[model samples]
Target: MRYIASQIGRSIRIVALSLPLADARDVSQWLGCNANASFNFHPSVRPLPLSLHIQGFNISHAASRFAAMTKPIYNAVVRHAGSKPCAVFVPSRRWARLLAADLLALAAAQKRPGRFLHARPDLVQPFLKRLSDKVRNYVIPAQNRVPSY
Candidate 1:
């Protein structure tokens, strides 16, 4: 949230701040305000609210998480927890589809195993392969040259 003086006249003041993670190139556009004293407006830009950018997840998302351990939080909650867990890591289908039965089952131990909200497996169509094998192979191999977009 650093400020910089853009032009000469301070009379028609409209400040614009973009997300920190936003590419530095886009800063000008984000802060690019209509600096006419007659037509006054707030510092924030259109579409994105000031509260969302200034006091939101955008700050964290842009930060460099260099060489830091990530999975440990999720692992700590269920895996490394020193108790025999009763449930599953959401079998891929349950994780994807937001079924009420799945939600109830996931919550209560009694309702979990037998009684489900969405009982019929046939009703659910599983997600197909999104990234093809050729793309996967190109991306997976570390040594191979994957073209940067």
Candidate 2:
């Protein structure tokens, strides 16, 4: 991410609301900028709520907390982001499959039809397609780097 930012030029303006303070500071340090560097485009820093903390799919604590919520993850996501595309990140192939199954179970129960995109779809089995017909088996990975403007 810092490499991509440097390519555009130094001093990237970041809105790190979705990031923990450690992550925010790391990003700043990697970019050769002071952590206190502020940009007018940035919103005042505030703590993110639980729902946005889904980056680690294999985290039993996070998953369990999410599971215990009165609103299912699927419903909360669909409600908060109504029809908009949503992205959930998971580390590793095993966690990806497990998280996919958990999400699909919820979606299936709700009878929600949606597309599943895989950067390396060939790596997954045919069973994944059964979850959704509009699945894109292969897609070039999107650049997740923060931009400097």
Candidate 3:
């Protein structure tokens, strides 16, 4: 992400991030510039809420938390996002496939397009076979480094 930012010479703003034993604020700080350096520590240094969402899909805690959320949570997310495209990230195919079905169903019903991206789509047969072709597969670039690290 930082590489992309540097390439574009634009400031990066993070809306949300989830990682195991990682600090989003510290990451933001590391990537921030001059006056906006403080903004890096807390992506939301401004009064407004940012929209970027990041998470480690395979983390147990994240999975447990997601499990605890009721369907209404998903509904609320879709509702809040309105017609914008939504992306759900998963570290593994098992969870991605499970969630993809539900999300795709929601998108179909809502008439919105949602994406199910996985690091290794080949590992998930169901995802490969059942997922809409519109779902994209993403592989993090090997050299893409974030100051957060």
* TM-score, model 1 to reference: 0.18
Question: Which is better, 1 or 2, measured by lDDT?
Answer: 2
**Model 1: CA > 4 A from native:** 1-29, 34-66, 72-125, 131-149
Query: Roughly what TM-score does model 3 have, to 2 decimal places?
Result: 0.32
Error of 3 at 133 (Å): 12
Tens digits of per-residue lDDT, candidate 3, 6-78, equal 9999867745434221354466556663445433235355354446544333546876756654255466556
Worst 10 residues of 3 by lDDT: 140-149
> Which numbered prediction scores highest in lDDT against the true structure?
3
* Candidate RMSDs in order: 16.5, 13.1, 15.1
Candidate order by TM-score, decreasing, is 2, 3, 1
Q: Estimate the overall C-alpha local distance difference test score of candidate 1.
A: 0.32
**Which ranges in model 2 have alpha carbons more than 4 Å from their true place?**
1-23, 30-71, 91-93, 114-149
In candidate 1, position 126 carries an lDDT of: 28
User: What would the TM-scores of all predictions be?
Assistant: 0.18, 0.37, 0.32
lDDT scores in order? 0.32, 0.47, 0.49
In angstroms, give how far residue 77 of model 2 lies from its true place.
Answer: 1.3
Model 1 pairs in collision: 15-43, 101-117
On TM-score, the leading prediction is 2
Q: How far is 5's C-alpha from truth in model 1 (Å)?
A: 18
lDDT of 1 at 53: 17
